[model samples]
Target: MGDVFKALADPTRRAILDELQERNGQTLFEVCTRLISRHGLTSSRQAVSQHLDVLEAAGLVRTRREGRYKFHDLDTSPLRAITDRWQLPTD
Candidate 1:
């Protein structure tokens, strides 16, 4: 949970999550390009890669390797836990 909060604290990381939500299974290059074209973010690929590392550490993002390429996918189960904890029961 602490990791989730820490990962969500950064705007760049949030943008990365949004990108994944918009289009799952994106490569690092695709993510960097989308962040610039769609989100107007000026972060470099290396910086975005670091951001992805943090997101991966938080369990918010999952990765798969295909040959030499790695794809990033979003995982929202941690977020579901937060929602489940706070949802009011119906009478």
Candidate 2:
């Protein structure tokens, strides 16, 4: 729950999740490209990488190495923690 709240505190991370949800298991480059287009500029790859690291640490995202690149996927289990802990209404 701590991790989920921490991860959701950042808009960038949330946006990253949205993208991954929409298109699961995207490569690092693909995630970066979506973020760049949505935010109107390419932030440094290092910056995006850092954001991914945080999300991964929070257990909200998972990564798999695909050849030379890492692919990201959403892990919604932490989100369920949030919903459960908060007792939020879910439809």
Candidate 3:
């Protein structure tokens, strides 16, 4: 839970998760290029690496290597856990 909050604390990280939701199991370059260009926020590859690390630690995302490239995917179960615990008001 702490990791989830930590991963979401940064806007960039949240944006990364959003991208993963749209297209799961994408290579690192694909994910980074989409987010960086879409948000008009330039980030170094190293910066993207940091975001992935946090997200993985939070259990909100997962990554696996396929030959040369690493593919990342969203692990929405943890997010569902967090959201389920929240008390959102219904209109």
Candidate 4:
């Protein structure tokens, strides 16, 4: 859970998650492009790639390789865990 908090602490990381939620299975290039065009982020490809690495380490993002191309997908299980941990009694 520490990793999740750490990853979520960054605005850039949060934006990356939003992008993945809006459109799953995006390559590094696509992620960077959308961040620029949609969010007005000026981060470079390497910066975005580092952000993705942190997200993946936190279990909020998953990756797949197809031939030479790599794709990124969002995983919401960590978030579900957070909600489940704090859910109130339903009675």
Candidate 5:
């Protein structure tokens, strides 16, 4: 999907996805902490939240609210569609 590609085009978003893959079900604060510690990204909490929003719109990220906390998870099914469309033979 166009949205998926667009969302993944950003290095920051890709890093966010990587963070999710490494550790799913992370809250916004957790995500920001890991991004800065692991990737040296000094982005603000609001900026990271906006990146999460884009990823969610593209279906790359899914979020669920548990009381006051919101946890983010990665969904790679959109990428599967792309691979399925042009799958190479194993032979």
Candidate 6:
């Protein structure tokens, strides 16, 4: 989907997804921390939150709130559409 591609287009967003892939179900704070420590991304919490918003809109990231904490998880099923759309024959 266009949204998926657009979401994956950004380096920062891709890094965020990579972080989630490495450790799914991370809080916003955790994601921010890892992005800085692991990926050396200096984005602020507000900016990273906005990137999460884009990923969420594209169905690449899912968010759920429990009590006072919100967790983010990666969803790669949407990527299947790309493979399916251009799948090669095995004949």
Query: Best candidate per lDDT, number?
Result: 6
- Poorly placed runs, candidate 2 (over 4 Å): none
Write model 3 residue lDDT over 1-91, tens digit each, in one string. Answer: 3478778899988898889989899887887798778986687888988888889988888888889878999987887766689956787
TM-score of each: 0.87, 0.85, 0.84, 0.90, 0.90, 0.91
Candidate 5 least-lDDT 10 residues: 1-10
- True-structure RMSD, every candidate: 2.0, 2.2, 2.0, 2.0, 1.5, 1.8
lDDT of 2 by residue, 1-91 (tens): 2366787898888889989989989887888899989766467778888888999988888899888877888988877776676796677
Instruction: Encode model 1's per-residue lDDT on 15-42: one tens digit a residue.
Output: 9999899999999999999999988999
- The segments of candidate 6 whose C-alpha lies over 4 angstroms from its true place after superposition are 88-91
Give per-residue CA lDDT, model 5, range 14-87, as digits (tens).
99999999989999999999999999999999999999999999899999999998899999888877678889
lDDT of each: 0.91, 0.83, 0.84, 0.92, 0.92, 0.93
Clashing pairs for model 3 are none
lDDT of 6 by residue, 49-78 (tens): 999999999899999998999999999989
Q: Candidate 4, residues 1-91: lDDT per residue as tens digits?
A: 3489889999989999999999999999999999999899999899999999999988999999999999999998988776788997798
Which 10-residue span in candidate 4 carries the lowest summed lDDT?
Answer: 80-89
- What is the number of backbone collisions in each predicted candidate, taken in the order shown? 0, 0, 0, 0, 0, 0
Winner on TM-score between 3 and 5 is: 5
Model 4 ranges with Cα > 4 A deviation: 88-91
Residue-level error in angstroms, candidate 5, position 84: 2.6
Error of 3 at 64 (Å): 1.5
